[model samples]
Target: MTMKILISDPNKCNGCRMCRTACAIRKAGVCNPEKSRIQVIQMDECDRYLPLVCQNCEDAPCIAACPKEAISRMDDPVLQTVIDYNKCVGCKMCLNACSFGAIGFDEDRGRPFKCDLCGGDPLCVHFCEPGALTLKDSAMIQYDQARTSALRRTVGIRR
Candidate 1:
């Protein structure tokens, strides 16, 4: 089976926030942006809205940061990093460890949450009116090397 990934095209996004509402409803049964796993951040400097979600890093910092080993990468076809709520200790380490600010903290639940791709059918992608969010096979998309370089620069990590 081909590995699937979620892609966000900022150029296509109009900041409508329908994606956030869909995600929140699917995940939390509410239309709250704060509860949405996917977030659209407005870049005032560029007047652009960027939808941010977990990149599913090969070496996910959130997994390593969880002291209770609650966060882990699912094997094989899924390839998603998930948090074991039973084992999670309500720590915000995963939120801090995320480079893209993809992790969200739930104040009521006292837990951090990230995108799970909605078990292979993302509501965020479906509700995205501008087609900014897409689910594509990993093999079909060309990797952006500049993104890696920029991430390293942002984190001050040389690798």
Candidate 2:
């Protein structure tokens, strides 16, 4: 089986924000949407709801941007980018480096947080009742990106 990456279908999202609630509870032991690693962006005027999470890029900018070397991929087979809380010094460089705006800040911890795929079984995916979030083969990411770009063009949404 190929390694999987998290993907989202904005068209399928109903903006219920159940994914956010799931992520927050799993990661932070709380029910705060603000603490959630996955964020639901509501474009009310356009009537679009996008669930944004870390892409876990092969060449992740966050890894390069971290001065403390706090961000790095997991050991073999898991390949997910994770933050080392012990090494993180509250620097927000990773937040700025993420083009997708997937990295989130925890004001209480003063550290950046992002989706780590919940150790390969994401709670967000489990709780996505609309089926907006799913794990796809890593090879399909390029196709998904192209589809997103085309959709944006058709909808007049600029990156």
Candidate 3:
């Protein structure tokens, strides 16, 4: 099965962090961004917030850099990349290899963690009030391109 990633449009984010809260609640049974797998980075100067999560890259650098071989991909339809916490040696290699800054340090365990798309359902997307996040297949890239082009045109005309 083909795996997909959810991208957040900075233009659509309002810095509310509802996605983060939802993720934490779903994964850890709490409502905290610090424990949440997803992170929302806000650029106050630009009036924008960008939610970051694992992109599930086909050639994932994190998986390759893992010396302990703790990270591996599941064969499920959603194609989740999961980490074997038992095998993890508390190394930060995966944390450094991820291009999107998706992996975060688990302070309690001194290990790294990231979004596994909530086992395919993606709790973040379900709780996102602004609909800023959506799971899209590879085929949806063209749709995203078109949407961005239209937005650019609208902005250009306004200016």
Candidate 4:
């Protein structure tokens, strides 16, 4: 009943870029990373490939900042944010507002592009060669549990 976002561990990613190719193929009908919704920024010296995708934030600033209301959470159980291209005004407000740098400009369509989680079955997750990406439930209870455990060992929070 909770929406999920995938994150890549820098240690796991090997700069293979299979995720980027998969994203492009699913979104653009091609295997070109240049047109891919997801991007893999390679830090070659460090042997790392940072897989960048939508974080699917609970308080999504992009949704609030869209002037045309083109971005909306899907009614499905996963509740992914979907951009209605027809309604998008190409103002780039959402792109600027997204802190994760997940949004990209579609030069051909003149609209911003972002990961929609592929309607619950993310191709990036499927095609991640190193198993660097995963779609897990974004549960508040789980987050609270982890936070509480971390805080208990820290000097900041007593409880």
Q: Kindly list the per-residue Cα lDDT of model 2 for residues 49-133, writing each as its tens digit.
A: 9999887788999999999999998653345788899999988999999998999999987988887788778899999998999
Q: Give the local distance difference test score of model 2.
A: 0.88
lDDT of each residue in 55-101, candidate 1, tens digit only? 89989998999999999977755457888999999889998899999
User: Would you estimate the TM-scores of all the predictions?
Assistant: 0.84, 0.80, 0.81, 0.79
Could you give candidate 3's per-residue lDDT for residues 1-159 as a string of tens digits? 445768688888888999999888888787768889998987688769999998777799999999999999877656578889999998899989998888988787788888887776898898888888988775577777788889989889532
Candidate 1 local lDDT, residue 67: 98
Deviation from native of the Cα of residue 64 in model 1, angstroms: 1.1
**Which regions in candidate 1 have their CA more than 4 angstroms from the true location?**
142-159
Each model's Cα RMSD: 7.0, 5.5, 3.8, 3.9
Which ten-residue region of model 1 has the weakest summed lDDT? 138-147
Clashing pairs for predicted structure model 1, backbone only = none
Best by TM-score: 1
Q: Which scores better on lDDT, 1 or 3? A: 1
Write the residue-wise lDDT of candidate 4 on 1-159 in tens digits: 666657677788887888888888899898688777787877678677788888777789999999899998775655478889889999999999999888999788798888877877889888888888877766865896898889787856665
Order by TM-score, highest first: 1, 3, 2, 4
Per-candidate clashes come to 0, 0, 0, 0
Q: What C-alpha lDDT, on a 0 to 100 scale, does residue 6 get in candidate 4?
A: 70
Task: Check candidate 4 and list the clashing pairs.
Answer: none
